[model samples]
Target chain A: MTSGITRRVRVLLWAARAGAADHSAVFTWKTWLFGWFVRMLAQVLFFATAGNLLGPGQARYLLVGNAVLMVALHGLFATASTTWELENGTLPLLVASPSSPSLVLTGRSLFWLPDGVACGLGAFLLLGPVVHLPIGLSAVALVTCLLVLVGLTTYALGLFLGSLVLTATDLRNVVSNAALVVMMALSGVEVPASAVGPVLGRIGAALPLTHGLLAIRRVLDGRGGGQVALLAAQEALVGACWLAAAVAVLTLRARRSRRDGAALFLT
Target chain B: MSLLAAAGRFQGQLVLTHRDYLIDLVRTPLLAAVFLLLVRHSGQPQLIAYGLVAPVLMAVWSMAMLISGEVVDSDRQLGTLELVIAAPVDFARLVVSRVWVTTTISLLTVVEVFAVSVLGFGITPEVDHPVVLVLGLLATAAATAGAAGLMAALFVATRTARTFQNTLSYPFLLLGGVFVPLDRLPAWTHPLGRLIYLSWSADLLRAALAPAPVAGAAWRICVILGLGLLAALVGRLVLGRVVRMVRETGTVGLR
Candidate 1:
């Protein structure tokens, strides 16, 4: 971390190392495959049924909804899985080995990138024929926006959740579920905010998910450039806030743990 | 008279179950309220219904899985599985007694959710077929129980029971006709869902609730019954194997 490499360079290195550590630590490919298959199948079934009810025109809507679900769930997964590592006493070694915690966390998030992409585009392609998504540059923009906004939002939230384990015990389900339910609900992943009413409508309006999802939808319609930049900017802002929150929590926990003799749990 | 006494004794084991149920109800009332409110306009808005049901199903499913995991892990932690196995209490009765407690909580949660939805959301399905609606609700609960039982067994048997609880059920919630209808799935994924108990539960619920007439009611019942039976059998078989494995090689932490 201190070999005079720039901070951005160090962060990338940490991210890659974190990804490697996670893959190596949790070497349950069989279980991963099983869980992945189950989720993919369930997602496919959901969209197929939704398409049946709304017709082809609404297929893109359902596809985007599913994409948001993937992002939200992945965020929870990455966050919880990382915290579980910390709680069980494996994260400290990586943290102390010249890599910043932030970089390592980012690296661990890379594993989900492929799956996230697949889930986002796979749902679209699988349901596109049924829904008649207009093929063009906008589709690319739609996928890109989803990858960045939804993806970044999830990563930041995951880090935030991971930070909670620093001072708390037995609050995993409560914290994880609350963060996920709010994110999913506010993001309008399950239903567009338009139908949920005024109070929730306002709340959703303030969140990044609504904008991120809307941006993706616009991209799907083949609109790009300035609009995409604006949407990305909104997502980046939300992501930055969440990222800051996660970092704050992690730093606080690290300081407290060191003072409390709980540093033994680190590495 | 002896049989009655025995049944009474069995019921007595479930005394703690009510407190458990009440505590959970208190904790999750907000979530339940929010869900029902969202679904008030489900009839006219398909997306709203999708949003409402996905989280509702997840909340309920998580409750069931968490309770079941608690049952299994506590037994494992306390090394009481062997004690319970050695006891002369009827094994079936033991399972039921424990399940009765969790199942009761789950049912009460469902009822509370429905009642709140009705009172708050003003959602009134045509009582033109109250019997069918009740039956549909019953089948849904049964299916949930079956899935819960199977999950319990799976977790009890596996080293990674905790992870399995989340990883396994996450998929079911997504495809259980909560967010999207079953018909939307590709033909290839249909067989996969049919293998999961949630598919059957969704089918039973949709048949009962969706503004469609019930056809082949007898067949639907059979399908529900078949799933419930299959789940019970599988759970038992898996538990047996897991117990054997645990006995032969001491259980260790999941990797």
Candidate 2:
């Protein structure tokens, strides 16, 4: 007798709790900060300094670009995490239930969102000045908002990919890692969209991280918040489309599997 | 040695058909793309050698040693560590054989990255000294296999082994001049590069690509061999100590 949206929200909230409980053992705060966070920062450093090898000016461009890439990584987390229900032998139960599985899937990896945002922001704040990136008060606030939007959009893309390959759960992580690697190459992360040429530029335009990275860079450029807002809105829109596609795929896959009453995705 | 060779060949055959393993190799080209494309965009085509060569060498480290380190971690997770520890075969030798398979397999990345550069980027990176290049590849494979011992020891030794392994991956790649050269890194980090065999191997391999005569190739190759031997010795000692402790504590069952 609860409203439909309300019930789904509750499922998401509870699923996020499960996810938090599950991953808490993987990395305590100390380990997460000193260990995982440091690793992400080092990755940013690796790319940024590599940029410096080309020319001094190229460093900050790469620093900002790779920093935002840390956000997209959370999206990849969503891919593997959504496949968890399939992993833990709960796919059949969740499919059998009247509740929507996509909601639960979304919530399961919600923990990665904050971690992604932290890595993105930490890369910016900690290493920004090393390359002489001007960090004013307004810049920080804008970049934070941009990071959140980018995280949500990329997470949506991840869910869609996860749903598409629910049965082949073993390849979920591979898909996520490969997709990220491809994105890092093709996305306007290290190179401008225009520079990748027309075909690749169009492909980059369609990816979640491309627009999000642009928004972050625009925010840093301080040309004004208007363009950044427009870019953020585009990122959010892309995310929404991915979210809708994810829901449709999840629903169709679940119903079809239930009808077949075979291949329960135990593996 | 024959047993090791046979074991390595068997694992290589199995991993060759493995979806996960093949996909791991597939990353080499994409990684190459990421590095080379950045150089292209930077308006410095001469620097392309670093981009072209780095991923191939990085594939050596990540594919051979990084994946090699995971052997123990995965065995532990699969509850096979106890069997491995108790097997009649020597544990270190078993691990060395597994690393042997991956090191040989890692060579395919050389072809993969080179093809990607020529076909994908239209840049042909030439090797001026094939003899030194071939010798460098052999020495690198040996050194990489040797380091796997250390990597495995770390995995068996600590609870934070995975994190440690993850942390070491890119830094090693960085030290190896994946996207940046060794000289470009901070002067203070120079000695640290000396500690990693990939650093010397990168210099040797890149020098082979240059048309100029490669000086001190023998010394560099010897240094790589020495470092590799040292790592293997240290790895065996640490692995023995850790296995003893794990057996004494009976905590192989625990993380």
Candidate 3:
């Protein structure tokens, strides 16, 4: 990008532009609404209706659980999109550049952040009445912010998975889809973490959506600040761990590529 | 029959080697796991039999919607639609065979769900009518393939087929009562739900697992087969018109 010091920042800006370009290529606004947004609505509707088997109370639980899952779903797409640079043949060029490749990879997925929040928020505001969520205006505002945290955290896990996909490119879809399934199962979307027993409960606690969801639930219940703050903090910590893992993996790959004259990404 | 077998063998190879087709392998069971989890957590673990069978049936329907739903659109995007039509092969049969293979793979969810239920939940699934269950499985697989073939024809008729695949997923899933029984669904949807082959398959499989004698199993099985045959026949006729429309409009290879 630029010269010696600020090259990282320059590459990040360039990566954002590239990500935006990719986004527009994939979706026109209308198709994005009809294609992606409508699917989210249908998915939430399916799960909420399935809750009818469990009665109305569980139906409400499912509506909230699945609607909040919209954020993690969109955000974890960063996992697949992270593999895009390599698929398009720009990955080698970035690896050969002076700026660290990790910088570019991390920054590009930022585009998914806001879209994810909107999905989470839209699902709630649209379907909440059917579930009859007792959400106040202030709570909606706060939950929107909490959804941003969920997006960032899930995207972090996605980036780590994406880094792994740099080598196993074919697993890109497999890995991302499997991860989505895991989030759906273990992330408090289907059943409470405690209900899944101790081992899975620990995993749900560590996963991205579990705490964020608890926080959202608390906000909707008009609970006090302490629970929300604690859960949010736990979510931020989980995200930080995943982000650190992603950075380490990327940095290691870059070092190995430099040592072997760019053999890592040649795959 | 040999032709169908050959076409199916070739398509199965592509599905194994290609990531696009193979991802369905993982997604089917994952969906089953979600159904099982819900069954357990919602205080009705006894309905584990329904939970186990539901996702397998749903997987067959999903294979129809997600894979067969886009078979034509995929060829259209690659400019292979006209070539595929002009070839010596029976295009409808080819599509049916390929989709049948995919739905067969989806049926493998039965094994996976059984393993998961036995292993994860310590609940061993029971089958009351072994003959009915076996016949139901074979019939369901056939009907799913036929449905997929029909979906392929319909998808090619519309411009938004690819995107429509995404939207088709859950709504059809809900309407078809893939998880819940049609009676459990709203009353108005019952007629429409009966039209889906999955509703029959789901009921058949659930009946086989229930502790009572399965009545009208033969009739239900026949209906599934009859619907499947009708779908395949209609798919062929509709596709003939689709080919003519594309050729006449001079957009055969373009869109």
Clashing pairs in 3: none
How do all the candidates rank in terms of TM-score, highest first? Answer: 2, 3, 1
lDDT of 2 by residue, A1-267 (tens): 569778878899998998888679678888788778887988899899987887867899999988999999987788888877777888878777777766777788888888899999999999998899989988898889889888898898898898877877767767887888878876788878887789988877778888878877877787766787787778788889988998898777766777788546332
Per-residue CA lDDT of model 3 for B1-255, tens digit only, reads: 998888778667766776756666687677677778898888886577778887787667776777776777767765777888778887777787778778877877788888877777788888879899999999988887787887888888766665567677676777777777778877999898888777888888898998889999999999999988888888888777887787688877765
- Supply candidate 1's per-residue lDDT for A201: 82
Off by over 4 Å in 1: A1-19, A24-34, A54-56, A90-115, A134-138, A197-199, A256-267, B1-74, B77-79, B82-93, B115-128, B154-167, B170-219, B241-255
Give the Cα error of residue A177 in candidate 3, in Å. Answer: 1.7
Model 2 docking grade: medium
> DockQ for each of the predicted structures, in order?
0.26, 0.62, 0.61
lDDT of 1 at B163: 61
- What would the per-residue lDDT of candidate 3 be over residues A1-267, giving only the tens digit for each residue? 356548667778888788988888877899879778887887887788778886558888888899888889877888888888877888888888777789899988788877788778888998888778767878888999899999999999999999988766778878888888888888889888877789978887888888999898888878949889999999999999999999999989888887888645653
Arranged by DockQ with the best first, the candidates are 2, 3, 1
Fnat of each candidate = 0.18, 0.56, 0.64
lDDT of 1 at B220: 67
- lDDT for A72 in candidate 3 is 90
Write model 1 residue lDDT over A1-267, tens digit each, in one string.
666567767677666566666655664766555666456545654544554565444445656666656665565556655555565565666445555555555556556655565565655565566556655654764576566567767667776776665334345445665555565555666556766778988877655466777777777667767987787778778878878888776666555555675653342
